[model samples]
Target: MSVIKVAIVGANGKVGRLLVSQLKNNNSFSTPLAIVRTQDQFNYFKNEAGVDASLTDIENSSVSEIAEAIKGYDAVVFSAGAGGKAVERIFTVDLDGCCKVVEACEKVGIKRFIVVSALKAEDREFWCNIKGLREYYIAKKAADREVRDSKLGYTILQPGSLELNKGTGLLQPLNKIEEKASNNYSINREDVASFIVQSLLHPDATVKKTISLVNGDEPIEKFIQSL
Candidate 1:
């Protein structure tokens, strides 16, 4: 038996780093692959984060430029985020870029797909809702719609407020809330990464399912599998 190969898009982000760490030690996976941004990121991510393996880099590359680099993976995680860029840029990456990657995945016959998305993307006043933030959410939702209908095995994770935290593996999926609800929750980026990886390995995983996540004290794997 061979360890499964996985690819991580936006492999330099917060959750991306944690994804790399989790994959390196997992028995079922090879060192998860990364589609990185710049030359600087290639070194920093590998050296600082310990993602060494047959990893490839598409530095400052567009989504279209990613196909050859990610050609032979079992799964691709879309963790590419806007990083406070212009609204237009956010649309370009979060929405259009994601679609392009999915197209590439189809072209190369890659079957498993996982997406990192925001929890309340459909709301008008989502927290941390800055000028272009709503646009970001809209774009992610549009891409999510595409994946659900694309006939591929896909999992879309819409996690609640993202916050700075040291890694903790405990995870809890959030209950779907109405758009006008006043409650809130935050998830550690590491836990978010773990959920994405687990979804990739499980064939019976939540395919065609879009789930929301929040920090919980329960074991992360059980919490997700029960969903």
Candidate 2:
């Protein structure tokens, strides 16, 4: 089988790191491109993770740099995010940065993209009136809109509050949970990573829709094989 090549834009992040590790271990992929921001991050993955991840700019790199990073990959994962509530950075990185990469991917003919977003984003009036994170989601919603129109094969995962638990691989896309039930149904980063990989490998799953991911007890490997 010809292994697919994928590029991870935010390769040093919690979710991004886990996905990077998974992609590295999978024989189905050509070595993935890991995009990083700082020297510290570049060194961390190079030394600690012991992966073939390459450093590229997610913060200050030119649009051409991003284009070059993903030029030959079969899929590109938009894991880059602007930390904290800084709404300005939200539009810049999460929205515009992603848009720039998508344009680059299109220019280079990379057809697959997986973007990680938040759940319950449409009802963000609660967060936007005050919280900075909520404002960030507003930008994500717009970015989602752009991906919908990109004519690219895309999978958007909208997980709730992220957790650090083990990856069971079962993703429960439940409807609005009761406020009290929201204790820790949050998903682990690994689960999200597995979903990213599965979405890329599966040909029948809906491409342009946003799917919610949450804690579940099913085996993810089984899910992937079934696909």
Candidate 3:
């Protein structure tokens, strides 16, 4: 029951904030470090959320600088994204930012890495028909590939459309997920955060795996064990 030390990139984002709160309350981990872009964000996480915070902008930092930010943590979670505000960010934040973090992990010898990726990112045909998302999907696909090719032990959690609903603590089996149309694949952000916690706790089940997540009847632990 040794406590794990975790650092979360994009700590100011929705999923990142939930993860920081969950980790602080869970005995399995230390107060997770929240890596943020601004002094204001750093202050919010440190003061309001009661966690350690580091001011590190993933979009602008070099691999070495990012490595320095996350230096001593046992695990690193990459949940940062461009949020679709700009097309250029699709390349910089989603694709290149992910690569930089993977390289940073390698530079520092950190093995455990978890990435929040998009559902169906690997299937080009699936996203090709969707308007306005081609670039985003492309970035996600490349980022997922970068994580796979890296030496770091990685778990890529490709959850469906992120919703702000409450956590159900359940997930549809990955095999059954594809049976439905892509439109039905949405999951709550809270559930995604919970799954992230479970993934961190049970690295034996999650490391080096890419899992598809959506709300369902089976408990998170059961779904994890079934893996």
Whole-model lDDT per candidate: 0.74, 0.77, 0.92
Candidate 2 residue lDDT tens string, 1-227: 79988889888888999998888899998667778878888787778877656677655666777788778788899988887746688888888888888888888898888889777565566457744476687888888888878978887777877887887767553443333245644888888888888887784664776776776655665544543
Q: Which of 2 and 3 is ahead in TM-score?
A: 3
Tens-place lDDT digits, model 1, residues 20-69 = 87888899998777677677787776777666432333323544557777
Q: Rank the candidates by TM-score, best first.
A: 3, 2, 1
Candidate 1 residue-wise lDDT at 13: 85
Estimate the lDDT of model 2. 0.77
Candidate 1's C-alpha runs over 4 A off are: 46-64, 122-132, 173-183
Best by lDDT: 3
Candidate 3 — what's its lDDT?
0.92
Error of 1 at 4 (Å): 1.2
Q: Clashing residue pairs, candidate 2?
A: none
- Report residue 136 deviation for candidate 3 (angstroms): 0.6
Instruction: List runs of model 2 lying over 4 Å from the truth.
Output: 124-130, 173-181, 218-227
